[model samples]
Target chain A: MNNVNLNEDQQDCLQEIINVAMGQASDQLARYLDTFVYLKVPSIEQVSAQHLSDTLKYEAQSVAVVSQGFFGYEGIRGEALLMYQPKDSDRLADLLGYEPDELSVEEQIIDLSSILTTTFLNVFASQIDNQMSYSAPRLLFSSNADNNTSSQSSISEHIQHNSFNWDTALKVKISYQVTDYSFNCDMILLIPESAIINITSVIDRILEEY
Target chain B: MSANPFCTTIAEQLNTGILILDLDYNIVEWNRFFAIHAHKDAKEVIGKNVFTAFPELPQKWFERKLSSVIQLNTQSFCSWEQRHHLFELSHTRPITTDSHFMAQNCTFLPIETDKVISHICILIEDVTDVCHYQTKLNKVLDELAKANRIDGLTQVFNRKHWEECLDKEFSRARRYDHGLALIMFDLDHFKLLNDTYGHQCGDTVLIETAQKISSLLRLCDQFGRYGGEEFAAILPETDLIGAVDVAERICKEIEKLVIKFQDKDIRISTSVGVATINPNDKRYEDLISNADLALYEAKATGRNKVCSAKEIEYILEE
Candidate 1:
């Protein structure tokens, strides 16, 4: 757990694989919502669990968050988190064909996040030659501005537990935003030290092939 | 399909509900707990499509959920809190539970055979008790929050909460330079009525008076019990004339109200003082003090009536 020092070739291979996976995820999301989704090139970095909370600059203080964990046969293991501000929840609910209210907003977010997370994780796992079993999608963060319950602490706890108490772990950020809309969602995948080793070997095989 | 005695015994005897479904969603195995809850024996459900057995199941969503589990080869969960219940099985204790359907927390685990998932095992745990208690707890918490902001006797905003609203209105008025008014009123002989009858009769009077005044005010008005025998209201976007009109309406309504308490009829009146925001006033408390001065003018001149702070200012100028 010293550091995740990926060589130039390995980084390129990982990024290329992530691009295809992320593209598939976006395509599925666009079709499901019937709107255009603009995605950034997914970035992979190594970060400590403690600094993980402060790692991303959150646009809104209160956000709706959906997280799901995936366990695979061939070393693909991690938790995927989808975060977005629920300010434009009315707009989102409209797209989902629901009257915008607290419950509808929550329901819509959970449904949309599951679609994004499932498509992304399934494609990513398949690319790495791994078959995954996904945990049910959970709305872990409260979107209530008045509710300042320890949401940050809960998220950090999930990150810590999923990282398996690794001193440092590889964090892959797959961020997206809707075109001509106010929605910005980021999907983060935390790969614990053990899973990273498995991924590295898979990467090496692909590298050997090319 | 294991014919092992221990596996069979534990599967049949264990309290937990268990069901195994193949990739095609055919019921490969249904344990005793599951069969009992689903109201179908193993022989009835086994080798049947789940949707065929339970037509109430949302087919499309269920199909998508099952496919996600199989394709990922990953375990997924459905909690009672999220979707209420997956199977919609009737509650076992119909007499005890108000719920028609028992709440269930289902776990979908892909049963891997040689690194290939052909079937999925679903574990359903009855969480009816948890949902019931959690709902009750949430209701109690909501009532507790309402109790903190409301006066139990009058059922209006209490003094602390009323003042908070006034402060907010005061700042909003200053920022937007909008019209804001305050009305303070108290029962003229509330103490005499309590002494003659009892505190319960006095309580009835306060409750009725508050209801009457609240009915007269606009939706934007914040009405509350300020103190003993006294009530206050913050009228947003109201001028002196509008404030006086509302005060007069409350005054006349209270004067007309006759509460038929137990063996007697009790009648009471209120002295209302109206005040508007002045340019010189530094805080919302100044508005309250001005309204208090107008209330004093109404009480000093005669008992049951409405007096305006503007009238007091005109008297001072003369």
Candidate 2:
């Protein structure tokens, strides 16, 4: 809509940083789950909070999502999101020896997204030369929640209601596929205008050094 | 960080553990909950590294966790379902819990100083009750799943579940070119027995006959109650001859069954049919139909006998 918020050089730098961070995180997850993790080349965008749901790769399907808020060395803060499509959960639960039920499957996804979020952000923080601290991962949306529980009905409505004070954010998106398994998920980091403005200053410094 | 004295002391006195760790893993502040569990005073361990205060604490894992919390400025979590315990603290309630040590779920809350994180307040809550109930619930689920696959009277696999098992075994046998045999048997005079002595007596005869035949078959055999008075067993890796031998043994076992019910001995006999994967067998249903045809032949020719599909076909050729 508006001209690309990031200059060509700035976008390139962010992409390269995301690539390295994602690679390490994928390796760590491969070891954690003992399954091959195939990562896509990550993309970054600037979008308003209103259009966030539309921009997401997944449609309004009832997806399982885990959200964690991270604070950096400065005033930099953002929420990390992991949205998983509901596929092969029963098979994965059988593989993990968990009860192949809705609750158990949701718990499995939450535990995994925790490892993946921290590992990726830790590397991304080091790349940007900033320390990151986090809020505990929270189950924001669950396909299981609708049938089992009465509340938290829809994901887009959940995101819209929790839209941060700033309307715009720097959204980083990456998807991962578990090789030999039908499980896959998308990881998103949403930094509001204020926090990401602080982040861009750090990005600028990295680019200047280069 | 300034706090409400009322809330601060309340947290200090609460049952759950409340401790604040600096970026270096040093304990900045703690409450009586930690003091009581670790058997240490706040004055002694508050300034020391948490791992140093308790040598048994998993330092490497905790250090990595604290690092992620510090660097990512994010909180992580663990559950008893995952790793069980992070701190080895004992609870006062021994009678309630089966475990000696307490099961704890921890929360690492970042204490921000003008938007920058300086300390992590770790809240430890005892989840022994939840964990125990969850474990109990899981056990019940396992039992329910087992019950769903079994016949209520006979305690053998139900027809639907047995069909599923047969389908899987069919694919497996086809893939590996392995032998598979099906046995279908029916009580010769089941309707007369049920009508003469009531359904209760008939149920007893079925249960006893199922158990007897189950004991005679190999462990790999998949036994199920196919119909009201009919039962089926799938013997993987068993050829036609092996299946016939098993059928004869089962027929003899059922013939000798004298089920005791209401101070009376009820005698019952069964006719068995055997079929193995032949060149003509295409699908699992084909094998089942062949076995059923052999069962019809066994009942028609002579009750309390074992019949094979190949031999019945030989008689047809004559």
**Best by lDDT, which number?**
1
Residue A14 in model 2: shift from native, Å? Answer: 9.8
Model 1 deviation from native, Cα RMSD in Å: 6.4
Error of 1 at A153 (Å): 18
Q: What TM-score should be assigned to candidate 2?
A: 0.66
Q: Model 1: how far is B303 from its true place, Å? A: 4.6
Score candidate 1 by DockQ. Answer: 0.15
Report the error of model 2 at residue A10, Å: 14
TM-score of chain B of each: 0.82, 0.83
Model 2, A74: alpha-carbon shift in Å? 17
- Predicted structure with the largest DockQ when compared to the true one: 1
What is the C-alpha lDDT profile of model 1 across B1-318, one tens digit per residue?
587879998988876788888888899888878777788766668888988887878776677667656654545667776668878676566777688888887887778788799789988888888888877765666566678789999999999999999999999999999999999998998899999999999998889889988898888899999998999999999999988888888888889999988989899999989999989889999999999999999999998999999999999999
Interface RMSD measured for model 2: 8.9
**Per-residue lDDT of model 1, residues A1-210, tens digit only:** 543567788889999999998888677667656778878988888877666756433422456667788788767688887887656454766554344552345556776676677677777778877766677677766544334233333443454345325567778888778865677778888887778877888899999988
Using all chains and alpha carbons, the TM-scores for the candidates as numbered come to: 0.71, 0.66
lDDT against the true structure, per candidate, is 0.79, 0.78
Question: What residue pairs clash in candidate 2, if any at all?
Answer: A132-B71, A132-B72, A132-B73, A133-B72, A133-B73, A133-B74, A134-B73, A134-B74, A134-B75
Please write out the lDDT profile of model 2 over residues B50-144, one tens digit for every residue. Answer: 88877777665566556555554556676665555677777767697797677878876667788798999888888877778877865665576
